[model samples]
Target: MLLQMKKKVLFILISVSFYCGLSQSREVDSLKLSLTNSKIHDTIKIKNCLILAGKYGGFSLDSLKKYTLDAIDLSKKNNDYLLDGGYYFMGVYYSEIGEINKAKESYKKALPLVDSISNKKKFGQILSAYANLLSETNELDEKIAYYTRALKIMESIGDQSKIAFTQYNISNVYRLTGVDTLAIDYLQRALISAEASGQKSLKGHILNNLTIFALKNKDLEKANTYLIESENICKETKLNLLCFHTFLQKGRYLDELKKTLEAENAFLTALKNAKKRGAPQDIMLAYTYLGKHYEEAGHAKKAIQNFEKAQEQDPANAERIMSPFSYMSWSRAERELGNYKKSNEYLLKHVKIMDSLNSEKNKKSLAIAEAKYQTVKKDKEIANQQLELKDKASEIQKKKTQNNYMLGTIVFLTIASILLVFLFKQRQKRKNQELLTLKREFQIKTLESLIEGEEKERFRIAKELHDGVNGDLSAIKYKLSSLLEMNNKVIKEAITMIDDSCKQVRAISHNLVPPSLEKFDLVEAADAYCANLNELNPSIEITFQHLGDVVDMSKKAEVNSFRIIQELVTNSLKHADASNINVQISNRNNLIQMTIEDDGKGFDKTNIESSGIGLSNVQSRIDYLQATVDLISNEAGTSYTIEINKETLNGN
Candidate 1:
């Protein structure tokens, strides 16, 4: 309620509102013209489509989606490299339209593409945009991590505009999370960058944010200074959307300064601008803030009326354009007006949303953890039942034979004939048992060969993708860069696609045959894997330790053992909800030992041997190495200990 008075995240609010004015700009017309020209290169058309889509920002989401899709289709048809922006913009559209989950997917699709591209600006924008997703609120660390990464990229590229916004984003997160000191510190840094960038709308937004921070710190004088400056900037720039937000903050600052009539006018102005801008979120916030202004002024009936208008804008969870503060304030207004039922309803909604935001939901972390728990239980139960059924059937068959033998013994006239028949039956049973054993061994050998062949094929494909296809793509990118105008953003964009393709190819190739395993020994590979995993998941820490030095196993054995450790560690990360994981290995004489442990709420181990629950492949690798594993899991954590005898593997 304190720092959160920054109130409601409207990420669709374009920082520099002239971008909003782009809808009517001649540039949009020019881009559209190029897109329709038959003589234009398909690559140029695709770039135009993306630019046109961006130009549609703050104007028509449908047009944005249309152009983005067009770009994606044309890129795929032309085998062009322009796809990340398509996905990124699609993510933005999804987020704006309240498809949070789909937005996340789109963001993920774009994230892997941005890593190899040379445009650090887009990289920063993508990260900053994704961090604004509502689903990211609970992942505090990851949210900051994204902003931090974006900030670094912006700094590297020396893009003051991007840097300012990134700093502002980081500040907003801190403000919402209640680190007021750090929030204000970063906000000040953002103001400096905004000044350096000399963008009026950007400067306005930063000053308005500072006004909120200043008011929160009870510095009315500072708040007054920022509010006035922000208002002047927004008015001068004719930024309607920016005016709505800046005016809203000005209203709050005036309210804090106890300027009743002035505060009322500011709120009304914000509402008028929001209507003109035609964004539901802006309208909703304006109404909510006006309602709060009236409520604090003791106009209970008027407060309820404005609150109702805000609720109308929302339309049964159609959008979350108002903050918990708005809801709570509305609830209080209802209570003051003697509407107990409405008051409680609003209050409950406020509390529920707050709880969800405060929860520790790190993207897919919670779902993976719960799914693993249930899956492991279901698999184990099924496996145990199958084993029991087999045992019962075996017992029944043994009883049937014993009964028949007793009856034959009783009917036998000579004891010697009974003895000869029993002996012959025993000899036949031994031969059958031998045949079954041989069949089982043959099946295991066949499986081993299949797995070995699969690995070899994977290695071959990895080499081809990395050395052949990837290399060729890189060469083309270099050639294009040399031939095209260096100042052309379109060429940079095409290079973006090539870079994305090259990265995608390398990723697939790595998955087929992990470069770490091929390039290093098991110990070094384990360390590299841990490092990579840690990088992928900023929410979790994975540590690797190797102790002792001894001999090397056969290649097959070493690989299988490496895989076992890999599988165990990855499983812990995905399913254990572990904050900390440790992988330790020791080799002495001919014995090698490994222990993978995690500080997570460990799963039930009942009937663990019955079903694999996706651990079947892990078990197969373990079996191949002739290794023994001891698995212990409890509330404290899960630990996997494995031992391998190098001599035994080498001899085999």
Candidate 2:
């Protein structure tokens, strides 16, 4: 019965994989038919060629290269500005095939024409592709430079999808280098841009990678959350490859969590799915994982069987499928099964593969050294040629100088006489303007420094009150509790007074610096404050709504924004005597928009002086953030709106 259940589950997974593959194949066929049947223009044909190349990239290297080359030739023949795009695709294909030198050359050819390309979107795409190739070569610095350049171009063009794609690639590189924090940061940025651009496929990819990163970080809960989201997206998009990988990752996570039975079932399902799709590499990986599980469980015979199956499914280029580890696993299983000879044989094979890999690495190093030598030699030749040209030019310049000296001296004197007088006046004006500007700058800086110092002191005092004085008072309270056993009225009264004082001190400390503001973003901090308000005043309902994506901002902006919202909410709860308070924070056109509304008796706009220190603090924070504020108050209710530009907060 258990076997039957396992077979049924495997069958279902295989069926799903098959359906997704069929759907994708049908789409590709439809696109091909459209290209063949239509009388497409040259530009359209070139685009179709590029699309076909990308579609074939994973399965057929020959076809991919052929189409990419055709696109380049056709674009050149037509004098189309998308020639750079064609070269970009060609570079991608070469890089995919491990032709690093050729790929780099193709990328170099494309970059010069990127700015000249009529389509800025395509130019940005090309730059991103080039950067990806650079990443594969281990040229991380150059890769980042190209990615940054691509980001600027994409942003300038307002191509959100390309921007997301570029960010995703950057995150991948960071992840590869083990920079988990930066990787997550870029991935989050990519997610925002992808969702905003309605690029569900790209968003799904980012989510899937994020799941892997979270798993690496031992954040199982976050990993599972990201995995579920990615799975949903893959199912919706019918992305068979991503679905296969997601199942594998899920199985690995389950295995790590010690859910052995569930992990085994997942691995079996992944194996079936990969077999259904004819993905040899994934099939081998699934079998390898299953073998490892069995080996760990002391099922030597079962482990050996699975390892053999993995070996059978492994591709010709087994190194690409982690062949060394697979071989080691096989050797271990064989040794456990008492097959000494076979274990020794597999071990030898593993060593041989490693040695061969090392040899290949050495050869690659030698090739790189030779290439560098040739480059240096060429540079020297170019330098010598430039020196010759410079010497000849210098001789000609000397002759020209002699001939023009008498005439030039007179002309120079006349021009200098007029220029000196004009420059003197311009200098006087510039100096006066500079002095005024410097004075204003000094005043602004001084004010900013004072505000910063004040905040720092407030934080210091708050920490001392909480961690020092408050701790001592708590200890004293504990001691007083012991005295309570005596049942003395005087002791009880003293304890009550101490408790009240402690409460007041705690409140004062919190007022100095809200703990939430220090730890959370503006939106989260505000939500926390509102929750606290609801707890204190059950009659008043405070609702918080965050729309769109909220990215991380500068600390100053976050702190000031939290303070402004806190002050507004407090006023509404205490002075306004409001029954319902609504707060909305949203991102629009790269600006943060915050709105607070309360249903309560409002004051007149003309009575600004009537408002207390809370309103003044709000204005002060707004000025610090360089944000715009609008307030509307009436007999019925009051509403406050603030627009904050993030660039201004970042000191752009």
**Candidate 2 structure quality by residue, lDDT tens digits, 477-579:** 8898898888989988888988877877786687678787788777887887787667667899999999987646777778777777877887887788789
lDDT of 2 at 2: 13
lDDT of 1 by residue, 424-463 (tens): 9999999999999898678678658866987888789989
Which candidate wins on TM-score?
Answer: 1
Clashes of each: 1, 0
TM-score on alpha carbons, each prediction: 0.49, 0.45
Candidate 1: clashing pairs of residues: 81-497
| Best lDDT among the predictions, by candidate number | 1
